[model samples]
Target chain A: MRFTRYLAFLNKPYLLLLGYIFLSVVLMNFSDTASLQGVRWALLQVLNVVDSFKTEFTYRKNLEAENERLKKENFYLHITNQRMREMVLENARLRELLNLKTEHSYDFIAARVIAESSEKGINSRVLNVGEQGGVRENMAVVNAEGLVGKIIGVSAHQSIVQVLTDLNCRVGARLEKSREKGIVGWGGDPWLDLEYIPKNIRVEPGELVITSGLSEIYPEGLKIGVVTDFSETDYDMFMSVRVKPAVNFNALEEVFVIKTEIPENIARE
Target chain B: MNKSHLRYLLVFLAALLVQSTIVKYMEIVHWRPDLLLIILVMYAVQYGRKLGSTAGFLVGVSSDLISGGLLGLGALSKTITGFIAGGVSRLFQERSQFIFTLFLGGLIHDLIYFYINTLGKEVAWRVIWFVHIIPNLFYTAIVGMVIYYFAGRWLKADD
Candidate 1:
């Protein structure tokens, strides 16, 4: 009987809801902005402690956010490390060019190859120097490897170089051993042809070629190329000499513009 | 406290926690099933008028306070719904009848709530009755039926 009485609390009930309903109506009279700010504050303070339990419940979510932050930081670190490596390489390249500049005491402006063209008979190069950098039409362009080209067109910020590979380009070149002058030109071939060297001249396959100073553009003694081969026929007066250019234009990057001015006497000629 | 009291307390707290935390993930057309209402009505059906009404008052006031809503709206409506559901529980035996009472409790709860909420304003009561109240009751009923199916015997244990 006592157990059934203990269970009877679940069975029978009363009109206890009316008292609460009355309290609800009273609270409604003082809702939002009237008289419960202190109660709200106290309740929120209680909730703040209660919120600690909620944080533990959502701990995995916080971990996910932390993971995302760390991943982004790692990616940023990788990009910054890559930039540091590139700067180091650029510093080494600039140092080597500095040594090349110190070896020659001429007034030369360092420039970089910005672009290259590969049209069949009209191969040319572009330099990141222009009239704004005091680059003129006939100034010689060279590098540590030797001559690159000459500035053919000058804009405000860029200059077009007619390189030695162009068929229309001609360089007055001299053999280092014999000191014989010839006009060097390309005819859609990988090697430059040095014309007007007599067949009687003693030329070897491995002779050095230098600028003849016969033109106002390129300065004298600037190394141009090496004689790779030479041949002659009984009927031909000139030896068909083949010279390989010193500058490997395919791998060219940094260069210098030798400030050779056109002489007033030869400017009209 | 006894196991029953601890059970009721944990269930109430869990209902409030789920409703506040993740119920929005299950929302349909910006309307979510009132999980708290379903649990409240289930409590009333198991316990009877006196205890049911008291539970309703405590839970409703907690919801009101926790939600930063008008201080008394949930308390008032929930108190009445608990009383009526407890009263009707004596007359109903089947699960289907309890489902109908869930619908009735939700309707009474919302009607009294909106009626009190828009007491002074010139509001469209019929529109609210059709739009918010009907859909919410339907959703609550569907969820209530499923909960009662799984946990009804446990809810009425020793009663």
Candidate 2:
């Protein structure tokens, strides 16, 4: 009966505060004990719920960040798709160039058009191949379409070609149908002039022009251009012939450098 | 728990979040107003010493765990602050008089906290009071006045 009265008396406010004080001091001294650590772990689990609440509350913010990431990814994929399309087109074009080499027995060196030197010499272009790679002066440069130019300058690793469209450049060309030979030259005009073809030579419209191979620079039987129009005049001794070049000079990327023969090492390159 | 008790618990959680996230931005030099202490003082003034100390113990333990501080230090200080604040609730004045109790309780709380935290070091009392305790108490009391202006009716409705 006395112990029950004592327990009832300990339930008072001041006595309860003392009990709490004692508990706090004990907790401070034994904070690192395993039992307290277990309690702390339970409290940490409560905090994890708080962390989950924070995450849900910030959902809109995370969505905005995710939106930014997707935008960057979309742009990167767009650029990659465009590059892949270009690669597909290049693959088909390279396959056509490979067929042109197999069709002809002439040993050829494939060179890429590095730059168009239109500022220095009109229609002059630089090639990635050079003299060290067996690109010598006066070697003919062709493509799958037709003849492009001839090598005029060469260094250890690069060569420059004076394309046929230059004002000073002239090619010995022949009409495949009429067997009429003339000097093909550009006079700052879009169409090439096939000079020295007489009025009675009977050169018709849409005639194919091929290199005569009369010069040491150009090889025989290489396509030069097609005759688009022909006009006869009384004062001129030869008829005026306008020939459109078979190769589109504006879209040139790859070409073949060839002569009578090429070295086996440069052919591998 | 009753509705009022649940409401106070939610308010305490909100204060805890704001204290951790936003209070650092409001810090001046090195001293800051303790929001948890202000809530404890206000709650103690309305309630009695018994409920005041209980709320104080819970808030202190939560703060210690969240801040990774030494355990039980905050509980010891806050328990005494709540008890003293509750004792002064019988003063003959309006509810705004609790600001004085807030200042007193704040000073006492800091004394207990710094004393125990520093292992009863009397050498740092001057620096502790002038630099930390005084400024923090002044700011806490001022903020408590503003909070009472807004939420004092909830406490007064019971009386």
Candidate 3:
């Protein structure tokens, strides 16, 4: 009798849920300048704080090890740093010699990946840096490991890094070894598929892929991933190469958003 | 608000924090169980549909905002899930195993989300439904058992 009595109110849950849904939808769509909008913005800031806390929280554990490595590897670090500087100068000289008009240059803002989406299809994750950190939309994200993604959406104190693994993400990448080029798209799996790689081109597995910087989104020379698998058929015009991303999306706790220091006017070409 | 109501709010808030933070470790191949859904279902069943539905909506909205998802999608889905799970609880007696109630409900909840959000025909339905959803169902069911027992006791819900 009690169970049936409750069944009589079964629809009550539905009604209640519907009401809440309606209310949330209404509140979310409420126009700007409303006090509730301010509350919503404040709540978003709370999420950002939580994100930064997650970044610093995880980095704390490895602080000692990182320090130790930095101390001991000073010679190696110095050499690598010198090599990087030389490469930058060489790249600038090459760009100048080619008489190619440089456009859309970016200054990278080093950031930490504070949080990531547990689920895929959701292309958004919170980063520790925001406008205060000099991050902006369309800025590329990478780590020492490789290309992460780009900043699709931003909050004042927090920004969203759309991981390259997201279904909606696409990047212009080229095979470093072969110079084979294609648009890399997330294939709804952990692996990324390099689309439009001509079948005739020889792309062997283990070839490194890097951002072409053909588009304004990412800077040149940033690592993307390594070729893991390639499917080629005589009948197909394109070879589909599966790439294993360098950045471990699963364990990523820190990242750097490649921010171009170039002024907006100079960037737009 | 009554003392008990405030207590429930605290518990719900704590649950949200854990769901957002540490429980992220439970992810398997991008298939993660919705902890908020489980809590909402349990609340809806025990507290009755009205409160359950309201809680569900709140959970959905909060999750969307915190997670930076398509703003209203999670909220809408959770509200419906809360109502359905709560209404379904009337089919069982109070003494049912925690696993039976929570695991089954949670499994169904995830499947619904997978289908609604990603399993459409426009994209590759093969991966979404067959590869992802089926595995996720089993995984969430296992997680649901643990969540059910502990959460049931924590919430002190009779049904």
Candidate 4:
């Protein structure tokens, strides 16, 4: 009987695989109610350990390269330091102009890009930040280059960011030089489209675009993208404009979730 | 039964971890292979439609939660994929490699989704049909082959 049973088991190898997949789907998907904070913290700690090791390894490798380069060209080091000082001063002055004192409030929680959307319908990416990291929904996410997106969903150690180029994303943006207001939306293509700008709003091909901050999703004055081209129709109420997004959706490594001061007057109830 | 079930649970957790963390970063022209889609096709080929549909629903929900899309969308898509894969499974000889079936299954699954997404009110038919569907089909089909080979090895020993 034991030999007969063993033979039966060998005959149906796929049944075991099916059972494995079935059980996995249930375990990973449905369990939402528990705090699971301890598990998340543990996982994050492990990830942090791994990430730190990776960073340290990279840093050491770079330092060795820098040492070799510095030995070869000792004279250029002085010029590089001076250049770095000047850039730092310029960045400080810009931050002052942006009113960094009172407006910039949220203590940013740095996150890592862990996952991205593999499906056609969903145009979202996952980050390592979540409720444990003080990430709240609608938090504006930005990289050093420019605006990235906002936090739409949160898990224990992960959150999903809908990038600016997604079809569902519609940003309230204004021309930096012209101050002409228009709504920027993605057309499922790489370029973003600016809609509802009157035919004669004085927009040009080279004008810069910035978030108007009307949507309350992103902070005002963040660089969104550059206007690449425009087209006008005689019967249309608004001109169709193409924009090149500032943030490359394909190559984003790290982004900052700006904690903008939501005005008390128009705050969501 | 209990020990084997525990092993199954571990595999699912491992799949979710990879699906959410690693697979998201893999892109070729904004096209990522639905790893869960590959998993579902594998199961559908192994199990009959009834069990396959149930597995599909579960995997879909997990995908939705992790992908952060509409909740039921994964469930709906996976269920459909499961049914189709199950039907297709009948066409092949029982001894055939699971990878062949998975390769065909993934191609059809992605095509169905691409058409469904592009046919809706949200997208221009030309844009969806040409830009989205055509590229994704080719990309996913190529990925499917890789996944099929590894899957056969992974599930064969584990099973």
Best by DockQ: 3
lDDT of 1 at A178: 96
lDDT of residue A201 for candidate 2:
91
lDDT of 1 at A92: 70
In model 2, where do residues sit more than 4 Å from their true spots?
A1-7, A45-269, B120-123, B155-159
Between candidates 1 and 2, name the one with more favorable TM-score.
2
Worst 10 residues of 3 chain A by lDDT: A31-40
Q: How do the predictions measure up, each by TM-score?
A: 0.46, 0.47, 0.79, 0.70
**Best-to-worst ranking by TM-score:** 3, 4, 2, 1
Error of 4 at A133 (Å): 4.4
Sorted into a CAPRI-style docking class, model 1 comes out as: incorrect
Off by over 4 Å in 4: A1-107, A131-134, A155-158, A263-269, B1-13, B92-121, B153-159
Tens-digit lDDT track of model 4 for B1-159: 344334444665566666655664577766666666666776677665665666666676566555555544566556666766776788888666355566666656555555544443355657765676667656665676676666555553443
Could you tell me the fnat of model 4? Answer: 0.22
Which candidate achieves the best TM-score against the true structure?
3
**Cα lDDT, all candidates:** 0.72, 0.71, 0.69, 0.68
Tens digits of per-residue lDDT, candidate 1, A1-269, equal: 99987766544454356578788988777765423745544444443454456556766668989899999999999999999999978877897888743233468988865444311233455566777898877788999988777876555556667788664578998999999999887633346778899988999988988989878888878887889988899998998888998887666667999876667664333
After superposition on all C-alphas, the RMSD of every candidate to the true structure, in Å, is 33.9, 34.3, 5.5, 7.5
lDDT comparing candidate 2 with the true structure: 0.71
TM-score of chain A in every predicted structure:
0.59, 0.57, 0.73, 0.65
Docking class of 2: incorrect
Provide the lDDT at A120 for model 2: 12
TM-score for candidate 3: 0.79
